[model samples]
Target: MAEHPAYPVGLRLTGRRVVVLGGGQVAQRRLPALIAAGADVLLVSPEATPSVEAMADAGEITWARRRYADGDLADAWYALIATSDPEANAAASAEAERHRVWCVRSDDADAATAWTPATGHSEGVTIAVLTTHAKGRDPRHTAAVRDAVVEGLRDGTLVAPHHRTRTPGVALVGGGPGDPDLITVRGRRLLAEADVVIADRLGPRDLLAELPPHVEVIDAAKIPYGRYMAQEAINNALIEHAKQGKSVVRLKGGDPYVFGRGMEELQALAEAGIPCTVVPGVSSSVSVPGAAGIPVTHRGVAHEFTVVSGHVAPDDERSLVDWPALARLTGTLVILMGVDKIGKIAETLVAHGKSPDTPVALVQEGTTAAQRRVDATLATVAEAVRTHEVRPPAVIVVGEVVTVGPREPE
Candidate 1:
């Protein structure tokens, strides 16, 4: 008769005795999962990798500083034999068999009674893929299939059927510097459940395309040159939508609070008596510079970095920026939305005692595939801007820290 397939089941190993053989890479890889499953893991090895040693020191697992003995599996619920020596693994497996404990063999899967599956988790869902460990079976094919499913779920393409509770509220989500994958797990989950998404120009646009057909996406970019909308209009839209019992997500690029006008919207929601939540995003003020290999702060170079808006010129009567004070600071200065007024800003800094030869770096469309950097000194930056025809949404860095990183290309 042909051999029967092994039974598949999820083990409730919580607080149960589990023996893990070896102290190498394979054992290191399996130990975390066992600990997560609440297994009372007993690791047997004369020596262990640094990571395993650290875990033992942290009291996450018990380390038995000796080779696997016959009594190690006496009352164990399960055993994982991953020793480098095949003889040692076989001996552990033999002892587990005598105690009626199922064993998973890393070296010789066919010799073991159980097999570990490739696993992934997303949005409270755990996915595990298993393939027959019989002589002719391939594990790679199963793993590839598992990865595809997980990616689909993450990107919102492959969704499980369920009714999403549409509690009317507002969420300020920071869409990290243009990468769809950079959005936080909570931000993505809340977005998936949204009825309305008020999106800005800098947030991840690709993620918007992944939303269900019923999700109402509103373009919130309303500056004079950009697709414009007034702040009051945006506030009204959010209030109106939430009042109609719709879940609203105000998604902006970088962080919602870092010059994102997020507080204005939140205050408006609060006045309207609507529940609101803010989900912080990775701010581009730091991430964008780092992406271009520009460290805003380096040891023995810059002790602090200042982020300011350059939407208005330093000479503009409406401008709130203290140009004289900023010029006097001996640290890195970062300016956002300043491409249009960079010439005046540079001139003002130069006039205020900031060195004309101070290095500056202009990063455009930062943290995206279209990112490009224009390097110049404070005196020549205005001329370079005109030559490059640099546009808005670029970050300008000044001070010595601009030249602290890798050499810029000519």
Candidate 2:
């Protein structure tokens, strides 16, 4: 091992060029920030998930749909290898070393020079939690503990350095779920540095308390049944802020890409030549139900699961989902935005093969302190919701999984 010298305290990646050599979730999670930090990111991987592919398709990031080569690192200021294969990541790490540029290996195994510390961002001010999670122990567990400590600290600390220096153009955020406390450590840091926050309406307002008292807030949400600002407008605003050299937060509800339009907005920023990054949030569709005493999947109840949207047109029969196939699948189905269409949806399910007696539940504002849940069967769900006057911002769990809930403590 070689001795590593201390580098500058604030050598950020803004306006630099970074090469990311992977296409799955890790790169997807990190790519936005690289762009947000004003880095011209070039992605080199054999495959890309839908979101990553979309970013590439939109030309937000340069794409090389092949394995990493020595020259792939050319003109690169930093390199990140996020491939599932450890060997490829090691190779990329080696290439970065030869180039004497910074590198972060997502695998974080042997031979990598640097690690992606637990970090958070809001605006351009970032707070990073550095820990010696050095090998052998669980990385995720260490991150969780670190984040707990970071969250407890108020936002006032970032002010001294922030006012003296230009805000770094990178933010590493952690998007908490409906419960604000679930946020990661680094997520807390970035929120403290933010000058403005463009957040989802559901991202636990209490969590925003960490921001400095004067931070600007914008509610650009597309919550079901509730009015929402158009996505184009939100993207334009984020880009404009960054172009004005202002740090901004594109805060999102869940992991941002779990049907949160994160990719769309991110692409818009890249196309507009604005900088960006992403902090993952726990998805409420699953976490919410689990927290509400309803298991969306269970042994014998359901062995398979699929999450689909209920926001489609009412009678666009041709574009509607295959009701018969879904009914025959014998698994759990989680429908987002299905509160208003329960009766017809249930009828469609039964008309195919789902039994009219199948168990169902409507979970509203799940995982929040204000959560409410009502249980019934396919035959009774429509009436149950109507009688209770349940609104949107709800998730419907179908199949026998809804039958497994708290037993009143015996």
Candidate 3:
């Protein structure tokens, strides 16, 4: 009999040696996440892609430029197969089980002990999105569905799961962006009723403060960066907590599903026969830019905009940013992780066709108390940020929308 695959109550992957059997965009897209969850990643690929290469060079993960061998799984605690070749992934999975390592095949849902869910995290919440048939699909297909979820998260249309139709006691809550005050009134109310808060580190400290002192709080870090928990641990925690007739708030930040991996968690709960609901909040993708007062799309200034992670799924030989399209188009271009790569981004845009004199702005800590604004032309923002020491969590806005601001004093 096959093991019934359901969403684990909650998940953690902290400090676990996990092998990624491929180095394409999927591995590139999922590696940072696994690392962020505190996994010690060992990337197995014949050749490194740009993203994977950068990570390996940074010493974030060890790169083995060879095929997956049974020896690689010897001490690995958890494994995920993300190779472009499905046959190779299957071979790796069999090796993983032989080593007794818990594993999930990125391209095949049923090939492993679990499926890595699409996730989103913010101030006080981490949500997982996964499919009921996660084991039945190709990893790329699984990731495609996850990407659709990512788009919903990007658009801010994705809400937390709400099965009020089936479960009366369950409540959905949004923990807000990296800040606690950003949470909504309804989210706070629902959180207050939660007996078990299945939360991740990103959940705001203040929001956690709102709970009664003794309320059970589960920290599913899922990586070695801090607490050591696994995805399975998180799933189990939610199920066990809720099964005890406890009101559980799977506290996730930034609208839960927005890269929060929320859908997986919700589906897991439902599959496990748990009652649930989802309350939405301001996702950082839009809110972060808007908070910085940078509109993703303005009436005339920006007609269309693309919001993508600066760190995840980066470009291959060249930038993933469609420079020519963005340059020729008349609209706003908001780059999230373009901060570190700001100079490169500007350089790319200028080389593509955008004027070197194009106006730009770097808003750091937007909508918060410590907001900073730096305005300059595409030629200057690179130096401007360096002179000012602008940091991450900052956003880059391009096009005429930036020029609309008042002139700097002479």
Candidate 4:
């Protein structure tokens, strides 16, 4: 006899009963979807994984501490039998069948009335793939298909309806450190829709290679220096492109507000009557140090971390930094664009009463494949920076917090 093909449907389980007859890995995987669907989940198990226990403790789900009884499925609209014991799963499936509730059996889908599909989501769209007609019900094929589809959505090869509408305006998007994967979903989507992208040298370079040929990419760092189009040129380019009814994206690195000069661009656009949007990106000050296994703050070591721009030398007449006050701070100090002036900055701190032996760390090209870490003290960091040839676009951390927290990458 030919088997009946399973029907596909999206169940609205909001505030409804959904019983899960296991607390192992399978239950852990399926529970999230059920809870996300707003199901009143009741989990039955003798013992559960720590994560499942934590969920129950958090009141996200109701846990039945004992084994499943025959009438456990009497009121369940849907039940999933994922217990390790074959007999327990079979018994639970039989009970669900008797109560006319749809049952999904992890051990034997052939005997169950429903099958879970491989699922992925992007930009308000949910994708589910089920190879119902495939012999032996291979999940690998469905998962592979789901992954390909989701990757396309993320990289802009596939576009969802909500993201298809590209309005003519400027979007200042922070691309995050250097890792392409670190770019926010919204930022990536906007990058795909951009007709012109004015990008910083530190922005995610890998993503630029994947953009469509029609998108004009301008390297902000290479913008003609000393020409009228330098800073003004960049500003004029944004305003001109937006006025021409083109979607322009000023792709920057790190959080736009974190010394990224994003406000300057925003003000330029506003004065020109060009509408603009700002999409925040993860800042390197915290994330870069975190990538190198250093915490900016530790409970007992340090409570505060200050981020400062070290582009200008401490003794430079145009400098605004209060070196004396910065030297007195007891917490962590993070300096950006300070590699060249690190020698002077170090001397200034020490001259202002900062201990010469204070621990310090320099993270170069953080969160990317070229990530390198060098450790020293206030007195020795200058020599270490020179010896390591630590370049610009690096983060400098000073304080006891450099030695606190996780020392090794997990």
Candidate 5:
């Protein structure tokens, strides 16, 4: 007997009754997607995985807290027979057959009426791949194919230029702590669709090389106290490209809001009536220290962590940070863009009653191959930076938390 090819169709399970006959790993994995589709799921099981229990507790699903019984599939538009008991699974399958409800069996796929596909979503498109023939069923192969297609679409390798509609706007994407892989999925997707990308030198630089040659890459690197692009110029570039119906991406380092001047760019776009999207990134404040095996806050070590910009000297009239108050707090302090002014900042902290022997760590180019950690104290950090030639774009950690992690190679 030859198995015929299965017809593929998306089930609109919204507000529909769905009966699941297991609360184990299989149900835990499948329940979220079902719930997301607005399915009124009822699970019949003696016990469930902690995650499944959490879902039930959250009122996302109805849990029977018992084994499957007859008439469980009476009004179910769909059913999943995945109970540990083979007899229970067989009975549920038979009930589903009698009721003409499509059911998927985790144990015996051949006996099931439905097959779940390897699914993924990119942009606004849902990708689903299923092996149709019973003899040729290969879940791993189907998943691999799905992943390849999804990755291609996400990285802009698979182009549907003619069929795809272009939206002209600016996307402020956070590239995330200098790691190319750390960028958010939404940020990466927007980059794939970008016509003009204004990039920073501090973030995921490797991704720039992966962009198609057609994309105009503009260097908007704001090198600290060095050669850099002006903020006004960057704002103008974003406006100009967007006004020309180009999808412009302002790719920045770390979170756009976390000292990235993202609001300035947004304000400029708003003034010009250009639509903008801001995708948050992993901030270097916490991630950089973590990358160096240092936790920003540790139990019984530091109760609070503060992130401050050190671009301005504490004595400068334009400085907004209250150095004296920060010094008084017995917690971790993370300073960014403070390499040049670290000596002055450290002096101010010590003068304000902070211990001069407070442990300090300078994580330069954090989360990248060029990353290096320099250890010191408030008294020695100024010298450590000078001796080590530690540059800007580094995160400086001050307090006992810096001593909590494994020692960096001397």
Candidate 6:
């Protein structure tokens, strides 16, 4: 018989009976999709894998605990014949034919009435790929094609500009801690859909280069004690763009709520009667330290980790941090934006009873190619910072947990 192209069609199996003739790896892989489609799945096998048995125990599917019988496909809308026994598989496939049910045979696709394509979904789009040749069918080729399409859709490389749904609002997207790939999927998608982007200096800078020419990239960088953009001005720009019915993305570094001033922007938009969407990103307080091979908390080493902003010195009147209380806690302390004030911070912690010998690590430009770690003690960290010419935007980790992981990169 000559091989022919398979006509692909989606099966709406909701509330439909799907009889699976095996409880092995093949059935384990396919059962989830069937269950997700709301299919009433029935498993017919004398023995089953642990995963398949768990599914039956959970009532996700019915298990007969027996071999494939003649009447097993009596009223099944779809059948999957995947038993280890070839004779049993053939019998089940033949029974499905008599019942006029669509059947898929795992052992012999050419003999089955249907074939499952390599399927994937992204951004509300389903990608299914089927590769057929006169010689044979290549499952790997089908999966590769499906993966490519799904990835392109997810990253907006395959987006149709004309088909885009223009949502006119301000999105406070966390671009994650320094790394462009660390940004959330929704954040990246929102950025691709943005007409106006107000970005910070600390956020993922590499992603900005990927934006289309039409996107207006605004520099809202708040450089430390240097040339900077005011928060009020950034808020006004977000409001102004959103009022013009444009999609605005306020791309910030790290988690928006984690000392990112995300709520301030959200509140400003709310007062201006503009809608806002907030997409959270991985916080640098933990991720940066982890990138430098330091765990903020370790068993029997540090029981708790505290994240604090060190933009202000402990003696400064504007500082709200309780230095005395923080020093008394037997845990880890992670400070952000405190490189310049490290001298005063170290003095305050040591004076407040924290040991001068407490280990400290400064991770600069963490998770990026420029990442470097500088180690010191509470008494020596201030000098270490000055000696190394360490700059702001570095995460300062204090306490014993700093010494719990692999040695800092040279």
Clashes of each: 2, 15, 62, 1, 0, 0
Lowest summed lDDT across 10 adjacent residues in model 1 is found at 220-229
Model 2: lowest-lDDT 10 consecutive positions: 1-10
- List residue ranges in candidate 2 displaced over 4 A: 1-176, 221-229, 317-320, 407-410
Which of the two, 4 or 6, has more lDDT? 6
Which residue segments of model 3 deviate by more than 4 Å? Answer: 1-172, 178-181, 200-204, 219-236, 316-324, 405-410
TM-scores, one per candidate: 0.84, 0.59, 0.49, 0.75, 0.88, 0.93
Per-residue lDDT over 295-333 for candidate 3, one digit per residue giving the tens place of the 0 to 100 score: 667676667766554553234455455666666766677
- Model 2, 15-79: lDDT tens digits are 67889998999988888877777778889999999999998888789898998777788788888
lDDT of 1 by residue, 68-144 (tens): 77789998999999888878888888888888999999898888888888888876777888775475667888789
Q: Which order, best to worst by TM-score?
A: 6, 5, 1, 4, 2, 3
Who is ahead in TM-score, 3 or 4? 4
Candidate with the greatest TM-score versus the true structure:
6
* Order of quality (lDDT): 5, 6, 4, 1, 2, 3
Show the lowest summed lDDT stretch of 10 residues, model 3. Answer: 161-170
Index of the highest-lDDT prediction: 5
RMSD of each: 3.8, 12.8, 20.1, 4.9, 3.4, 2.7
Return the lDDT, model 4, position 153: 86
Task: Candidate 5: list runs displaced more than 4 Å.
Answer: 40-74, 144-164, 221-229
TM-score of 3: 0.49
The lDDT of model 1 is 0.87
Candidate 4: Cα lDDT at 103: 92
